[model samples]
Target: MTDSRIAAESWETLRARHSAKWRRYPADVIPMHVAEMDYPVAAPIRAALGELVASSDMGYLGPMPEIAPAFTAFAESRWGWTPDTSNARLAPDVGVATVEFLRAHNVSRVIVTSPVYAGFWHWLEELGIDIVDVPLTSDFRLDISGIEREFANGVGHLLLCNPHNPLGRVFGRDELLALAEAADRHNAVVIADEIHAPLTYPGSDFVPYLSLGPAAERTGVLVTSTSKSWNLAGLKAAFILGHGDRGTELLKPLPEAMHWRSSILGAFSMSVAYRDGVEWLDSTLDTLAVARDHLASELKRLLPSAHLEMVPEAGYLAWVDVSGLNLGDRPWDRILEEARVSVVPGTELGPQYTQHIRINFATSPELITRALTQIAAL
Candidate 1:
């Protein structure tokens, strides 16, 4: 879990969701939406890219041996987990890795918690899997018993997000271990998308499920990436670390003709980001903490009638209750157009949460302040 009081910005995300209005706003008018950031990419990352560009080395690419240990170091430093490099395989993106894993396993049923990331299902449609949506308990933790029931007929997979998207809820060791236990019972794989792991509140703990003692061996936990915390989604590189030879099996069975796999640039970027960008990431986390708090406090003051989830842990997503605003079935759009701010709607995440608007708070302080004022007026 990230410290809520430290940083204040969800920039890249803000820009993406609010781009249309951002284009229309005056030079100073802030469009508080989207997940893209206003901050320049980290200096070290920029320098590394510059060095690569100077060499004019962009061309056809292949695997690099430097990625695993670098990421391993990051895991050890941040989460106290030592990833078994042998169990890891590279994937282009977390979402792709997830849906592909589901399909590869011949899975026809899925389980997920809502209000979740909007793109969670982008990879599942073609497979025609039975989608099982479960609302979180009032406390926002996944209901283990409920999940077990959903798996009564056998849930082939569970898409689990830590430092979860939209809600920003960071589960503790016990919380994640419970899910691992359930997955073990059903012999289902738990695809853990920990892309947001690196940005937790300072001093807060993040536990990778596999490290939760012995139950993980049969759990088939797959950690997607550390890119989100580093803001490298565009890099499209994630890793699958599976124990007991599962990762080897998955790679061997990798769709024979699938060539749009990990990219050279993506691998290079991840290696550099994980190995040398620690300080830069620390500062980014600080920025997000401040921005999320401001966004939360502002929403409370402006939309007092709305029920905002008090985020206990997680990323920069501010899930605000917008159902009371009288925008039936389209509250996210209603707020987007009316408030001139774009946000990931809860409806996209799941049907149970139609009234919530997930705001990306990782942006410039000024834009967040402006977006809040607009929402207040709306």
Candidate 2:
């Protein structure tokens, strides 16, 4: 049996680190805010980084032909869908890749489903693109009809979050196919940010947008990385995957510096992670599953009024409706002040979600218990 506690890093060790998750709040505050996992780095990635540093091989990023094959292999093995590797391109991170993909396609306006990743709003704002929000259904599934309406109304692009953040809803193949068909009908483009696909829990199927066949290949562009899955965001490397003639044409306008700006260490480490990090990933998933269950049970026992609605099917983020707690319009502020437990305010994800809060359960069951206990006491 896999040791479910294997991924839990000691609080003492984690607290001493300089990452933003630890540093943003004071010593007294327990931060469950950031998306970063509290698990130790994967062995393959660590070894690769150590080897690179030991040889003093750090230099400008160059042709890393290994990235494409590694990603394709992982995709094939994990999802049974092999992407075309010839059109793969590198970028500093997912944000940069997304921004550049939008810019290259001359997309002036885009549709986003909320409550979505907070970064999506920041990215579009930076590009001066108009945002058309088609919020998900109350059940946290895609508003396919709403999305189709936006595309029909002349919104030519969409920024999608697969294995959605906060909600942790891994969209199904039927939903994605419906979306792909809608985009094809409207001559629209879909840029799928599949960063969380690898973290999807068992029983929830994560459908890759580009894997939906001809319509998807024509209308979809994929951007993903080892950063989210392997907890390597600070290392700064991600890739853009294009497919078919339309996909290939859309990527042609991306600047050459997009690849050059990527860190060599990040790129090489990402390759190593894709090629050799499966065992560690599987172990971490087991640990995460244990943590996720702990959060659900603790919340139900300690804070019954806090409605978890649906347990997350992927990743460690849990969206809770704290309206029942009567924490007011700004519940997160009250929680921060009283409980000293920091979590993401739902308003940051979408304005209508003021009564909600996003909790990161990527830490140990003990930390989850500690944080929930603090919040429940309020």
Candidate 3:
């Protein structure tokens, strides 16, 4: 209820904004679809960008030596692990970093756990890489045996999402170690998209893939950004970190332009965010925690049959199974039409998830209540 660092703007104010989340829907619809947050940017990141523009330093990105050290410090403080900053390389975003890394490694086929981030499918399809979908377990945990089976079948690449997007399940260290061992045994590469790692809740442990020791270092590649955690996607910058020499060798095939193509503003903003934005980040997490719980409670009270199987362990997304609502196969579409609240169709995340929907609950509890109330009325 404190509005100091994490307050979302008024509906009128958010409606005036030009972002896709606001613009994609008409005034009649409440958009609970996009992953972007409604909160203001952290003060440190805003000040840094303001200073850059005031100084007219709008030139192309140059040496961002600060990035490595800032990221190292943040990683150490948050996760008790220090990455090999020497192998940290910049890209325009996580999508570009993932695509470029897979392309550089000549990866023709990759294993993806579903229902996962929709972008994972798009990124792989763009490269014409064969996708092997190994769905998560019934409880939405990693299907390790299924993944191992795929690896044994000669799938040499795995695209992982930790603090996973739609479901918000943070992969534990034990699970990651098992995965690392499997990848090592099969000489497979694991590219982890850990963009949401920093948003993990207090009780859940988010293990960075590269922090799993020798096997992970040998077979793991990490792609992350300040975009998801700090809400800086528009700034357009992300980094890939490798474990050591082997990690470095794995990334060697990426083109030099990958570094320069990044926005200078994005690069420095990320550095500032990592180094100085922890206070704001923590406050925002607290706010999101409340919002997440509010969404769950409202769902239970207003729509008792809707299933939020797991109270999300990280991020603002809530994946609900609405099959019990009996709204038919494409419930998201029906909800949009009847409730006038737009949410992500679960089928987009994976083919088999037709009766589910993903809601963005990073706003006020009032807004969450309103959205759910409207759905309940339906």
Model 3 C-alpha lDDT per residue in residues 1-378, reported as the tens digit of each score: 224458888999999988889989889899999888989899989999999999999899999998889999999999999898787889999999999998988889999999899999999999999999999998777888999999999999999999898999998888899999999999999999999999998898889999999999999999999998999988989999887789779988998999899999999999999999888888999999999999999999999999997899999998998988999877888899989999999988888888889999999999999999999887
Residue 181's lDDT in candidate 2? 96
TM-score per model over all chains: 0.89, 0.98, 0.98
List, residue by residue over 101-167, the lDDT tens digit for candidate 2.
8887778999999999999999999999999999999877789999999998999999999989988
Candidate 1: list runs displaced more than 4 Å. 1-33, 256-260
Candidate 2 stretches greater than 4 Å from native: 1-5
Residue-level lDDT of model 1, residues 89-183, one tens digit each, is 67777766776677677888888887777777655666787778776888888888888888777776778878777777788788788887887
After superposition, which runs of candidate 3 have C-alpha atoms over 4 Å from their true positions?
A: 1-5
Relative to the true structure, candidate 2 has a C-alpha RMSD (angstroms) of 1.2
Better of 2 and 3 by lDDT: 3
Candidate 1 TM-score, C-alpha based: 0.89
- Model 3 error, position 333 (Å): 1.3
